[model samples]
Target: MSLATSIRRNLFVLVGLGGIALSAQGAAAQPLDSALAAAYVNNPTLNAQRAGTRATDENVSKALSGYRPTLNGGISAGFQATRIRTPGALTAYENLWPATFALTAAQTLFDGFITANSTEAAESQVRGSRETLRNTEQQVLLDGVTAYMNVIQAIALLDLQRQNLAALEQELRATRDRFNVGEVTRTDVAQAEARVADAQYGVSQAIANLSASRAVYRQVIGVEPGKLTFPASIERMLPSNVDRVISLGLSQHPAIKASQFAVDAALFQVKVAEGTLMPNLSLQGQLSQGYDSSISVESTGAAAVTLNLSVPIYQGGVEYANIRQSKELLSQARIEVDVNRDAIRAQAVQFWGAFEAAKSQIQAAQAAVAANTLALQGVREEWRVGQRTTTDVLNAQRDLTNSRSALVVAQRDRVVAAYSLVSTVGKLDAQSLRLKVRAYNPVTHYEQVRDSWAGLRTPDGQ
Candidate 1:
């Protein structure tokens, strides 16, 4: 080959490789599934909720301790001096060193219903905490989905704006050529230039929006988003019946379950308070050894056992007042359960309606895009033939741009609405979605610690 041709071919190859590199960079910047999964695992809000749930696991131990014996031990060493004096008689003084040690245990034999009811209440609290954590997870997931959809929509709109700008640039060049030939006015070229500038501005705004959305996505999911691939058919992801959704939400929604658990816990509290008005019986045992030089050179040891009963006569009516307060709190909890149920039902209906509306809007926007594209093409042809004014061409371009933007928005809204509906029905958990993360188990920790007090006692069951 000639030297000039070889250089030209090399330059073309370099340009092609550069274009590919740019394309790859753009693709790498897109949010992906792995990013979302990482975000799901590492999000701080979700982690905090998990920590809160773990903290409640301690309640199980606190409750179970009531059924177990408590053992305590202590040791002390001290010095003492005593003196005796009589008027006009000889005085006597003595100094002695003493050491003492003891171990004691007590077991509750009966406490009316306080211990049992209190333990039950703690168990209910643990369950409530678990449900609250699950609810937090659902909220985080929904936020992640919303931010993801927003970024995708913004990217789509930015792409549309770029295409619009390219078309306007071409029209500007054409209008300038026609004006040079004295066929079109300078106003045509000026309008085309203004449209191109407007499209560029839209692209800038879209980019800014995408950045903001990505920040929110990162905030919720706890990691930077990688290249993302969304489901092609978002409508198919939605459930059909609002009634079924409401039923599921009422049954499984964490807020509703938590409220119910609160009521149960409050009922137990009332029982515990009423138990305080009765009598408590406990068995206590102790073993001790002491040494005193003044009394003996050797140590003395003693063992004792006792039964104790505590009968409450009066404490300013505090116990009764507490029971009354618990009853009122229980009533509030019941009301909360009702409120949560109604709220879930309303949210389900709204999300279902939104999903359907977004679907319809998508179809309408798609048709508008097609119609606008054809109309713009017709106007361009007419302009070439000096049959269409500059304003008509500009109007058609604006319409086309609007249709494209609307279509992107509608597509995003449909996906978000579908996810919202799923969330409203309380089925947004990892198990429900079959997500590939280890499910958090609250029971194992609770079981590990609940009976720990039994192990704290001496081998002889002190």
Candidate 2:
């Protein structure tokens, strides 16, 4: 709504509201789902987290390596000479050439369950990394949603500002006409001119803010925002009450999941460290050949299999120190789980409050806009009949503009806050929202790579 009826009708065209938008060379019909999909599929930060999780998955294979056999081969060649001197020696000197090639293999029969525990620890880390990735996805998607809404909010504010400018220009023209006819004084016309300038300044500020919001939208969503239509409200998707929200958040938050997994991994790490104090058993085999030891015409070969045993009696207390350190880390990890739970609860409560605030603000702003629209209309008419001053009309217009802008901002905050609450509950991902894009599965890489003896290429050959 605008103070001037003529400008109100032209408002849509004057500021591109609810119509074709002035943006990049594409159809201006971007939807929230598409924006989120783009961020999920192509956002570098989220994709990097995916890569980091995949990398973590490889640790499982590395830890599993302890259970596998190790093979090594080597070759060597050398010359040997000996000289003997006595009163009457059988032979004064003797020379021989020696060469050997050896291949050794060792397979661990037992290592105090080190491989099993380490593999479990690595697997826990993989789980933690996956949960971390999910958290990142939620954050990235929420950021995209917020950025989109910010752009749309900025556009609406700028449009309202332009509407204010147009309304003020209309008032200024009328005041100028009345003053020319000696009906209104020059001071009224001057006041109208000053208000028009202020409205123009407001429009400029809105334009600058819109530009900044667009930049952020482009950065978050990976493309310049097109003309955006308001997506359907997700308030229905949120928990009905704060208690339910906190319950869901505690049960499902990715930070909590990740922290829990970290604690498990740390416990396993403690086991791994303690494993070093135990004895290890392994089976080893070696084969060697010696050639050209007798006038270049003799050769000899040998083969042996040995059971190797190693018991760590004491070695500067490093193993005990490592065990102590790992236990301390496990303790820290357990404490961090509780810390993450509290942090997520705080986030849930904070976002829920924000959502409520937005609701109240929206209602209040809407009422203010309605009342100020009426006041502006009345003030303009009273000015027409010398019952009110130009200053009154200007103040009414400003009040209406501020109220409308506040309503727009509150509407934007409502959407952002709703999505943020969903994220805090770890349900803001594509799977939760049933997005169109196929979800990235971190387990696929883990299953493909884990237990693999050797490989240079990835599962998909990349």
**Alpha-carbon RMSD to native, per candidate:** 7.4, 3.2
TM-score of candidate 2 against the unseen true structure: 0.91
- Candidate 1: global Cα-lDDT? 0.77
Clashes of each: 9, 0
Q: Candidate 2, clashing residue pairs?
A: none
Instruction: Report the lDDT tens digits of candidate 2 across residue range 201-315.
Output: 9989998998999898888888878868667778878988999999999999998999999999999999989899899999999998888766645898989999989999999
Native-to-model Cα distance after best TM-score fit, residue 305 in candidate 2, in Å: 1.3
Instruction: Extract clashing residue pairs from model 1.
Output: 30-226, 30-227, 31-226, 31-227, 31-228, 32-226, 32-227, 32-228, 39-221
Per-residue lDDT over 1-462 for candidate 1, one digit per residue giving the tens place of the 0 to 100 score:
554554344333321221222112455644334444665688898888877776787777777777888899989989889787999999888777888899999999999877889889988999999888888888888788787777666656676777778878887888788889999888878888898898889889877987887788778777655655554343454566888878888887888998899889988988988888889999999999988845446688999999999998999988888989989988998899999999999998999888889889978876676677678778877878888998899899899788877877877788788888878877777776666777777777677666665465422244
Error of 2 at 271 (Å): 0.9
Compute each candidate's TM-score over C-alphas. 0.87, 0.91
